[model samples]
Target: MQVTALYRHPIKSHGRECLDAVTLVTGQTIPWDRTWAVTHEASKADAAETAWVACHNFMIGTRTPALAGIWAKLDEVERRVTLTHQDLEELTFCPDDPEDVAEFLNWVAPLCPENRACPTGIVTAGTRGMTDSDYPSVSLMNVASHRAIEQAISGPLELERWRGNIWIDGAAEWEEFGWLGRDIQIGEATLRLREPIERCAHTSANPRTGQRDADTLGTLESDFGHQDFGIYAEVVNGGEIRIGDKAVLQ
Candidate 1:
């Protein structure tokens, strides 16, 4: 197999950025992936701490599908995030600045449904990323399997819907399921296939339009008999991995 793509989500439930290469660290999530999350006003997440919290405390695609329509660019040096949406003016601000945070909240509050918990501030957990899985992991996807899902639905599905960190080609459709407990080598890094990633309603939203345009869960249940679309792997040996790197079962 070969690595076809790489991605990083600087902020959870927001936007993603593509990378050509990355250095993997053992027992850690991909670099800058989910480094920040927009916490709701009533969220239990403590900004002063560095512990993982439930995803519900933040503005997420599952709760606010409109977030998918946003594109974010993180300027780490400036400690600012630039959010752009087709229907909204471009907003750039520092989440660490009180005044800027309030500005950010004001800018995005309208996009989020008031009935749901509204985002109030930004939160982070030190160096670790806030991954969906409680454990540090890198999500992997099979291009063939994604194509299978699209074929079953008789429509095109954007890969960003799944927000995988690593995408591989050359694997048979759904073949990664059998890889549980196996070790896989990609470029110079080695990872242990942990478990199949369970699916969620967030997959139903189109990343390009921020609308619930597909019944991804329904299609999965009806055709595949499960709501899983990818796998989580724990980095076992740290090394540099790049797009087009060779992937092999070890």
Candidate 2:
């Protein structure tokens, strides 16, 4: 298979940005994927929780569709996050600092609070916290698997519905279903397929409009034969990967 598309959230549980190509460092995408997250006060206060940097734990997908449209850019050097939308230009801040982080959280709370309430703190690499998701680092999916789901739905599906860091093409439809426990090579990077990604209420939330589709989970279950799609992977080797990178099944 070939690398079809690449994406990064910058902030967890927010919208995704498509990339023509991406450089994979270690097993994760470089400088863009899940580098920041919004955290609840409990998580922020817990100095022992290193995994609180992931945003999936605190952000509710069922309540807010606007979360899907958020685009992020990360400046790794300066440790800054820049968020942008159609009407809004880039709003920049450093997630590591308490004051700046709080300001950003307050700024976006009104944007998505109607759908779901966000935590008061923003977490990033600079912060000692971790993401809310089960995984420590990244998420990935196969294009072939997505195509199978689309075929079952009898229409086109938005890639944003199932947000992932990497999108690989060229595998047979639904082939990713068999990849659990297997290792795959993409460019110089190596990833071990972990488990099937479970569906959540967020999948029903449209990233572009923030509207929640109650039937999304049901549709995945009824058509896909499972409430799960895509595979979670852990990076075994860090390296640079780009679009068109060969994904060889090892």
Candidate 3:
């Protein structure tokens, strides 16, 4: 197989950014992926949390589908994040600044439903990312499998809906499931496939329109016998991985 794409979401449930390449670190999530999360008024996460916590404490795309359409760019040097939406003004601010966090919540509030808890603040878990899995993870996807899903549902869905870190091509449909508990080498990095990532309602939302436009879970249950789309992998060896690199089952 071959690596086809790379991505990182600086803030969880906010936006996604494409990367040409990245350096993988052993036992860590992809760099800058899910570096921060917007905590809601009803969230139980403490702003001072020093370790990773469950994703339920954050204001996620699952709660507000519109957030799936938001786009983001991070200026790593200045630690500034820029968020843009079709209906909102461009926002640029450092996530570490309290004032900036407040501004971010206010800017994103309009997209949130009134019945749901409002976004309150931003929080981080030190150097580790707040992945959906309890363990630090890098999500991988198979393009052929995505195609199979679309074929099953008789509809096309954007890959962005998956929000995966690495996307590989030339794999058989659903063949990634066979890699579970096996080590795969991508470029110079070796990763152990952990488990299939369970599907979520957040994926039903169209990433381009921020609208609930698909029934991904429904189709999975009826056609695939399960609600899972991707696999989570733990980095076992640190190395730089780039687009177009070879991916081999090891």
Q: Which is the leading candidate under lDDT? A: 3
User: Which of 1 and 2 is the better model by TM-score?
Assistant: 1
Local distance difference test values of all predictions, in order: 0.87, 0.67, 0.91
Candidate 1: tens digits of C-alpha lDDT, residues 1-250: 9999998888788787788999999999987788888887778886644588878777889889888777777787997878887667899887668898788888887679878987878888766788888888899999999999999999999999998999999989999999999999999999999999998888898887788999999999999999999999999998999999999998
The most accurate candidate by TM-score is 3
Q: What TM-score do all the candidates reach, one by one? A: 0.95, 0.83, 0.98
RMSD, one per candidate, in order: 1.3, 3.2, 0.9
* Candidates ranked, most accurate by TM-score first: 3, 1, 2
The reply for model 1, stretches above 4 Å from the true place, is none
- Which residue runs of candidate 2 sit more than 4 Å off their true CA positions? 20-32, 41-49, 53-57, 86-90, 114-116, 125-137
Clashes of each: 0, 17, 0
Candidate 3, residues 1-250, lDDT tens digits: the string is 9999999999999999999999999999999999998887677776644477788889898879999988889999898999988888999998889998878888998999998888888988856999999999999999999999999889888889999999999999999999999999999999999899998899999887799999999999999999999999999998999999999999
How high is the lDDT of residue 226 in model 1? 96
| Candidate 3 deviant stretches above 4 angstroms | none
